[model samples]
Target: MLTPRWILLNRRKLGPITAVAGIVVLVIFLGSAFFSGPSQSQLDKQKSFTTALDNTFASRSFRFEVESKLLGENGFYSKVEGERVMPDKVHIKGTVLKTPVEFTQVNENTYMKDPFSGKWLTLKDIKLSQSELFITELNPLANFNFKDIPEIEMVGEEDLDEDKCYVYELKPNVVNAFLEEQFSDFYYKVWVDQKDVNIRQAIIKANRPESGNSGLDMKIRIWDYDRDLQIDAPVKASTTTQENVPY
Candidate 1:
């Protein structure tokens, strides 16, 4: 029993309401597209940063002096001093002090040299590829290739000591089968300096099933960096192990 006039009136009211709703939706979509994700310029910048890191790693070779403190289960502590030469060579000479055991890395090999016994005990190979190091070092920088990475998002900005930095959170990228198995359920959070595009901090949590160390967490902090020398050296590095014994 509705009149044509009533129908027209209802249509007019609905039209305006629908138009406003559509405008609101469009605004929201545009806002999310613009503000919620990285801009095109940012993506390009990331690609450039990644390429720079790749070139840096490929072209440069340098010496590194590293000092690290390893914390074991049940609150035991061991300090180590290491010197590494790039192009697949490292030498670490240090003592646990408490256990009086010496650890050393010659070439790509890692060993525990016993002072008491005067014998060298060879350990597992500390293997790292040039490409792997390139990717690992570069991925922290802003505007780096991130489409291939999953669950990786810009966390925020941070002030690391005196340096201002950008923080990013990285989770396992399942599409990469090698990475999926290698970094299962792991979170790699990196902090990169704004000015130099150098990584300031890297925290990694990994699962090692074959070694019986299922849950492993470690942090590497590059307290100082030299772009002139093209080295991202860690002034301080620390590792936490579930086992009470030093490996």
Candidate 2:
């Protein structure tokens, strides 16, 4: 066997060049993998949705309203307006089942307004009918409870209360003790403020309950975060008869 000097020399010169070419190809593959799939805009959208969800939960002082409708003959519809202050203070006034209802909670004391008489009463161990409806209504943050944020998208932009807001539609695994029994297929939406990253509004809709009643639809609006909106006792317990309210 005879070794060719020209062929050996060319092999040595091409070896390094082949190595460099392979390195270049590897770099290109890594870059594509890193940059492609789930575009940058999608990542940014998910980040904003998560931030707004966190901000809404951390809020101490905020005014909110929740409007809910159940689609059936026996289904209840309510539009509740409420405000929450840190430590333990909440005032809610709204109509449930076409009856006017109002309640305010401060520390251990709870006050309720009679739907018929329109008089405030101190609640000790009693609750009005369909009181479970007020759970998410009283605290707007309750609706944002998600076990996992699996899908998020920037649907569009909208103006809420004169503030420009970015609207996000998200599919999140929900965990709610209140509606767990009868609801499924939960869909959520949030309207986040552009400047402050505040969740100005949110909507939660679920597939019709198994009871054959129409599904539930809830819309929530939030504002005045951390602002001293002024919550005070509307009436003294002594002034109103004590009602055995158990909540």
Candidate 3:
């Protein structure tokens, strides 16, 4: 539903993510796992579980909704919704620190609309690529990289938007630099498609004693897997792609 004009009018100046990127040394934010036994059934279960995660992460195209909160807070702190088209294109919009943020990316270029001047600016120099730092920053799923995975078990099954899904619970440890110093206890509840092995929904909760009593948590819902889509750059005349960068 977010069109070119809608994004330009709605997005605010970058805040927390921008701060993280500005520091340079501490960016690349974002995070899973399991145990063993003496039985063949256990091994099969583990293999199936790992396979679901692998296939889901391999989802090159999908629409996603990521709602995250700082632990010990009263309500969700960040509510972002977006779509990603494979290779190198993304569109995301939501609020951070209670301020709206929106952007579109195609390859090395990141486009944003200045809240003050209401003008589009293209950051062609930024490398928010899959192989580098900003992958986790833009794609919340990239944060699922786990340094250690705790015991995982099939928790239940459910219907998400009419899609039959298998649900699993995992208490994982991750290295999300964005949350490293401030958050702890990465607990996840994931829903995967019954037939496609693709992830459908996930919720991540972490503790942050400083925020309040609720701590921090994030919920992600993914859909429209691999659907054909077109994500294009803004107009040449209206966007500032070649001028000196102005934030």
Best by lDDT: 2
RMSD of each: 10.0, 7.0, 26.0
**Model 3: how far is 219 from its true place, Å?**
0.7
lDDT of each: 0.48, 0.76, 0.70
Model 1: per-residue Cα lDDT over 1-247, one tens digit each: 5799899999989998999999999999999998877887667545544543454344323322222232233333333333333444433343333555434343444444556766655544443222242222212222223335556566678898877777777764334334445445666676766776755566766554454444445555543332233322222222223232242
Error of 2 at 102 (Å): 1.3
Off by over 4 Å in 1: 1-37, 41-81, 93-148, 172-183, 208-214, 223-247
lDDT of 2: 0.76
Instruction: Residues 1-247, candidate 2: write the lDDT tens digits.
Output: 2469878889999999999999999999989988787677767866887788778778879988889887766677889898888756888888877888788876666677777676777754332222564677666676777888777788888988889999988777777777777677778888999888889988888875555557888899889898886767566443433434444
Worst 10 residues of 2 by lDDT: 124-133
Name the weakest run of 10 consecutive residues (lDDT summed) in model 3.
27-36
- TM-scores of the candidates are 0.50, 0.77, 0.71
TM-score between model 3 and native:
0.71
Which number leads on TM-score?
Answer: 2
TM-score of 1: 0.50
lDDT of 3 by residue, 173-231 (tens): 78667666667777888887877877788888888745547576678888888888777
